[model samples]
Target: MADVSDPLSLEWGGRPARGAPGPMLAALEPAAHRYRFQQGARRRSSVTYLDTVDRRLRKKGLSLRYESDSDSEVLVASAPDGIDTTELGEAPVWPALAEQLPAGSVADRVGPAMWVRAVAPVVETEVVSREITARNEDDKIVARLHWQEATANGSPTLARVSLDPLRGYAADAERIARLLADSGEFVVPERSLAEVWLRHAADDEVERRPTITAGMRADVAVATALLGFLDAIERNVAGTIDDVDTEFLHDLRVAVRRSRSVLKLTGDALPERLVARGARELKWLGDATTPTRDLDVYLLELDELATRLTVGTRADLDDFATHLHWERTVARRSLVRALQSKRFERWCESWRQSLTEIVSSGGSEQSGSVEELARDRVRVAYKRVLKRANAITPDCPGERVHSLRKRAKELRYLLEMFAPVCDRKPHRAVVKNLKRVQDILGAVQDGEVQSASLRVFAERMLDRRSASAATLLAMGELSAGFAGEQRQARDELTDALPGFLGSSVHKRVTAMLP
Candidate 1:
């Protein structure tokens, strides 16, 4: 990995006057046609060189050098804290420039004919590292690099770039070659390049301005924090099972769920693979903790409700509690087995790999407008919630519905997160409708849980033979009442969903988000 703490300068290419090719052109022609400019503080100085290498002729390696375009010579550095070629990729520097290409010109022609120069002050560098271990039958090396650098001044000047194959040279070589060839003819306008670099310079000044919305800051902060948190969780899971602290594990599970929910609710601003893998890990963690958590909840409820029962009912409750204890014991054992399972270990490994890809893909650094990203995330979340709601099974336990309700809440929260940047009225309306859906689901789940508890008590009394005919009759009546409540709750939930979604308010909200 390049040192990010030193100052650096990078200069790429520009068309020389028609009369003669300049020294810079002479330096660049032998190398790849594309060039990159980077300059800034220690960690912030460097230009990314994507697809600059030709793989077909590996024996002959190509490297970039800066030449004097007019007066000054292009400078390159390898400071422990300076600029390096770790950030470039195949994505066009100026996407809109492509549209401005001349007839028959492969590259887009836009902006200034003058030279391109880009510079920024370094803020930070994120590094991901791993060790290679010999397994039963496989010898593999693992390495990853993902980083974000912000300008010295707190501005929206953060750039995330993925380092090319840090381990597999052959694979990376081939990939880079293919990317360059496939990019066709591409040209970047000097003005656009200058604009991007200038944005970094103005970052500090912008931070001082009051017009900069708090919502934008919050969104960036949350997204950055999430990336770091997920990285930590992935590392812990991959390296050692013992490292998985209960609280940390639980929090990671929640974070994954929350991030996914937020992403879905807002619309997928991030990459799909990251969101999908995070959701998968969340599900795995949920499953791993389910038995213990479920038993814990059941026991708490049993203890609380037992005290409120009449003496005869108490007896029934006691028998039910005993059965629950037995079930809990069984569940605990099952949970332990699962935690130690080879499958679990493999799942963790897979998750770590997926997370590595997401972190290193430079997906976070793409050029889309932030507002567009946020709106997309909200839309995605809404769709996910709707799909989950529609998929609810009658046979699923009350706990399932409770989980779904929680998901709905997350989606609502995400929509609210985007309300400021995008239109809020529609999001507000969607939230209102979503709240109705959540309330109905909540009621249904509550009724189901209560009814299940009552059934457990009834079965226990029948098994123990401790109750008289009168006691049995009373228990039967209680069970019948609980069942009625459960049915009513379900009916309400079913009847209310369409209205909640179809209302004019919901339609308005959907329009806003979309």
Candidate 2:
């Protein structure tokens, strides 16, 4: 392919009338070297734009499409510089993971961006087009033209006629472009066909963060922030209900958890009844999602956990893996039912409308701005974490460390929500410090929980006769490994906690507060 550095340098798209050669092509203007046209019957085709649940491919500056005609399916990847296409012998089922694609450039390009997430059809459009070949007297094709029109979700889009100039046909291209420009029936569009298709997609809103402004009202700002989280929950519902990927459900649960934390930490700015009800409703959502999410985590990590074994081979966990899948199937049924329930549906709607109303109503003149509220909240939460950290000793119960972890999490959320108001460098510095501590905390927590959960799983497997004796023994070894890993993480925490507890860190945390 030649360099199309400027897509508009050729003024190619024209809205032509039916049956005629098209306003741009019909006028032969002043070209002595005439071109003949061969038109084919119009046909229908479809292209489905696919990406990770998080829109990772879009972020990486690429587009992948599964295009289908009457018989064959092809996967196409396009960027500004060029395009690559590969034929898929057959179309894979939807909600496809990046790693599942056959080995090729397209898979290699998308795999890193997708990480663990699955790719699904973000936008699907059907197009009908008439193919026209413009050729010289030698019957050598000079250009390929398509009178294409598309519809997405039953609405029309990309309604235009376009021409692709063949190599070594510069004179014909220039002359045709001049004719179109002079006719004034065609104008240069800023976006390409793919951009236009994605523009109308419902999932185009990838950035979930609410743009909270400076000096916003306390209650209104909190509501706005919470609304963003609520939007995320609603956005992930369809994917989660469909079980598109574990990440979809994971994202939904994170949003729900964030919403709960915000209400618990800053609900005083809003009415007590509203805060109470919102927290209660979100708690139900969180509980409903927890079982499936827990199973998803184990299933996703099963391969890695199996790799860590010396006492048993990877094949030993085959029965254990099967048991997990069976449990997850049962758990997902309950989860999907809850997600599709009227209670869940009604809560999301009421939650959004209520929050939006509060935001529209504005805060009282007597109330402080969000920055002020953030300062108070951050200050209090930081001290709580500090107090808890200081109280943790070498032999303190696991509950104490867990308490500290909770306080630290609340502090982290406050920092993130109010980050827009804080100094950029200071906020990043504080978050960096908090994230380090949080990582160790997470290790400790996951270790204890996973170890206990493994024992329970082992018991259930035995009761159901679903596991071999070898698998049960392997699970015991895995549980012991988790216990050891937890011990190691605690030791790391003991060595690292003092740095975070120091005066310089406190100063940075204080400075980051709005």
Candidate 3:
């Protein structure tokens, strides 16, 4: 694995004048060798850059691209392991899950970072490239120059020249770099071609969370938060309706959930009728979206779930996969209809206008500052969680744990939304403590729900004769996996409760909340 961090060349923004020696290389002063500028190789390749929804790879200082021409198709990674190459039998389809790609070095590199999210083309550039080498008197390659013209749809054409630095020749590379800096006609750019194009393609990037302050009006804060979530929900509607990818629906559901959470906690600050209508409509939207999203989770995890089966071959579950697909397809139709219905569209428009009006009006004077109101809510919500946690017994049924989980989640949301007013260190420590326990609770709920749902799915498959006896038995094993996982989480939760709601964390939360 190679870790190459330095840029191979000093790239300037524009092409040089035609039929003329470019300004920078013309000024290179070779100490001991005569310079030779001759054309080397020319090729045209289609290049596409890829990233996850959150730009995970780019954040890690890595870049992945697919370059294809007549002779070969390859994945080029400018990654921590230097420049890595993985050959592909054919070009990959965009929005491909990591598992869909062939198992190799590239897949191993990117799969874990991508997690459940799909990797898709962030930008595509058609590049016409030609290389020119700078040779010394010994015919040794001291340096190389690249002339490239890249263009993408709805973006300005990129025409640049770069000097490729040679190893053990820092002086020569420095000479070229200085000459380029001195030239008035050429200047360096801060961002790479991939970064520029990704920005160009992302036309609808909006901040998902609202900015709130302690001294801000309670009604304005609530309105601002709700409005932001409304935009996110509206933004994802088209992608969800079109079934572009699972994340579209996932994001939509998150926005819907956050909106519900905010209103449930702080709806007292907003108009009563408006709050009532918004809650009703958002709940409807959530219910309408539940079926397909649940199936999507199962389908996404089916491959890994199959591997957990000890009694049946993975192929035995092929019918199970097919059944999930058919169910997702059918569920998706209902989801699309609900999103496109007249009621949904009308509610979106009305909600936006109403919230915008409130934001513009600086909110009603009846509501107090967010600091005072949220402080009370935060204290009450924390005590609620503590009370619920204290009531849970190991022998208690799952419902007690579920009830506690709900209270903990509500407290979590309040802490997150009001974090701006809290002391940074203690706020962070408190949230970390809460998340540690939340993960276990979430796992328990998921395992319980999935195990029960798998049994129902198996019953359906048997009734419809859609699955063989082998497939059903394999499902039984998978269900047992989920049940075992649920049991493990319950045991883990027993140990986590004291650490989360104990005296140390209690004091930290009290000191941190506004």
> Which candidate should be chosen as best, given lDDT against the real structure?
2
Residue 37 in model 2: lDDT: 71
* Candidate 3 local lDDT, 40-66, one digit each (tens): 556777889898767777777667788
C-alpha local distance difference test of each model:
0.44, 0.80, 0.78
Deviating ranges (above 4 Å) for candidate 3: 1-8, 11-48, 66-75, 84-93, 99-109, 121-132, 135-141, 147-161, 165-175, 178-210
Question: In candidate 1, what are the lDDT values of residues 145-226, reduced to their tens digit?
Answer: 2223323233343322222334444353233334332443112122222234333434654463222123333334235435
Per residue, candidate 2 scores C-alpha lDDT tens digits across 33-137 of: 567777777677888888776778777777888888897888887777678777898777878787688678878777788888888888888876676777877
Which ranges in model 1 have alpha carbons more than 4 Å from their true place?
1-281, 307-312, 336-370, 380-410, 413-433, 449-479, 490-504, 507-514
Candidate 2: where are CA atoms >4 Å away? Answer: 1-20, 26-44, 70-72, 79-84, 88-93, 99-112, 126-139, 142-192, 199-210, 393-395, 502-504
Ordered by TM-score, highest first, the candidates read 2, 3, 1
Clashes by residue pair, model 2? none
TM-scores for all candidates: the values are 0.40, 0.84, 0.82
Higher-scoring candidate on TM-score, 1 or 2: 2
> Which consecutive 10 residues in model 2 have the weakest lDDT in total?
1-10
